[model samples]
Target: MIELGKVEYYLLAINVIGAVVYLINMFLYRHTSNGQINVIVTITFLLGGSAGMLLMMLFFDRKAVKENMMSRVFVICIFIIQIIILLIYKGHHAEHVTFAFWKFFADHRMLLIYFGIMNLVTFIVFAIDKVNARAHRSRIRIVTLLGLLFAGGSIGGLISMYLFRHKTQKDYFTVGMPLIIIMQIVVIFYVMNAGW
Candidate 1:
């Protein structure tokens, strides 16, 4: 069994809780004003979240996603479909509310910027770690990597992990990283629906 630290467990729990809560809220009367729209978004999240988590888990189990060209193409296709569906849903809903996108962006731009910067930094850190490993040099601290990933650099962290072929075998990155991404997505979903 892969032993996860307390923090990893906490993050995983938060991810499941957040997604479930957000999904429940989406079905409530107050939140489900746009019935069809809400259904689309809800389904997308349910499917996307489940698929994403499954893929990550598969990677954690050492399935060698990188080794098989066909598997890589299939996974990429699924990921692209998920992104497309999410974008379409967001764009559709944006049209209903006047300047919703702008308002949301304006209010949460700082957070978005922070997430973006942190992800980039985290990706660079992971890439550097991979280089160091290859060169047999000193390495970045595990705590530092975990800290960055928890602080909203998850998407970047995962991207770097896969891109650099670094840390993919570790339970922390494979499992914990997906959990973080799910939590972040839930938070973003909540903030978008929350009227300013």
Candidate 2:
């Protein structure tokens, strides 16, 4: 049997509660434009990926169901922006959010790599899905994005999804996202026990 540590336990508890809160908020405010608010976007930014897209959608253009020249440009721009934001993470205003927490957390660079890989994978998978046209293009891009996220690299995927609106909501996300978080906990357990 797996035992949860205090930190992992608290993290898990917070995630579950956050999900519930997001669900409740979605049901309550689904129709409202509250998602446009930066604070609201930031709060769920990592979990939902809305923060990045909120601005684009408000300022640039909406994502259409079909692919076109403009859609290609949009995807390209989103990916580039994700890369920029991630590369600039060290200098972000959020750095001061918790100078102390940085000491305990794993290397931010490794985590950033994890995120970048997930989003890149999501992009490839999404492209392949568009070509297949078999029971596809149902927002599972978000799932692939978040699945990779759960697998470790969620921050990158999270940011990508927000900008791309890849896997906003879907059955895959419902299951895979939580599993990713759980896997991280398992890895943490192993690391702590393996004489790290």
Candidate 3:
């Protein structure tokens, strides 16, 4: 049996609860505004990804993750699922929103700006960690990195990982970061599909 830490449990609780509420809002309000649906979907995937990450951490053995080809297939499947969800939402709501996805995104410029800022911050943190590592100074904690990733910085974190060669060796960074990206991608698509 896999044991989850207190923090992990708390995160899981938040994800599950938030996802439920978002789903409820999606269904209960049949005539929900585009903006409201966008926000709800954003929150849903953000929490859903966080929860998925926690579940993976609790149940996935590090050795298996590191060595197994099947695990890679699983990750790809998850990514595909996220993409399909986005496509479905977009297809269903396109008539309700902009004629094109690009215009839909333009309508939600503020969400993109927020994501840009978070990614920038995440990138800077990784850069700072790299510098500190080279200088032989105290390192930034993994928890902080993970927190930023959870808080909408997966893209930045992944870029930093490859760009700075930081945290690449760790199982969490390689595996968990992609999972975070999957969720973030869902959020991005949710905004793109936001009915307006």
Question: Which candidate should be chosen as best, given lDDT against the real structure?
Answer: 3
Report the C-alpha lDDT of model 1 over 91-167, residue by residue, as the tens digit: 53333334355676677788879988999999999999999999999999775786788688888999999998999
Residue-level lDDT of model 2, residues 111-166, one tens digit each, is 54665676577556654544444545453443344445545554444445446555
> lDDT for each of the candidates?
0.60, 0.43, 0.63
The better candidate by lDDT, 1 or 2, is 1
Candidates ranked, most accurate by lDDT first: 3, 1, 2
Report lDDT (Cα) of residue 83, candidate 1.
55
Clashes of each: 0, 4, 0
Worst 10 residues of 3 by lDDT: 61-70
Q: Model 3 clash pairs?
A: none
Q: Which prediction has more favorable lDDT, 1 or 3? A: 3
Model 3, 50-141: lDDT tens per residue?
33433443454233323332233334335455545645644644445333646745776877788889999999999999999999999887
Choose the strongest candidate by TM-score: 3
Query: What ranges in model 2 sit over 4 Å off?
Result: 1-116, 119-147
Candidate 1 is scored at a TM of 0.46
Best of the two (2, 3) by lDDT: 3
Q: What TM-score would each prediction reach against the true structure?
A: 0.46, 0.30, 0.50
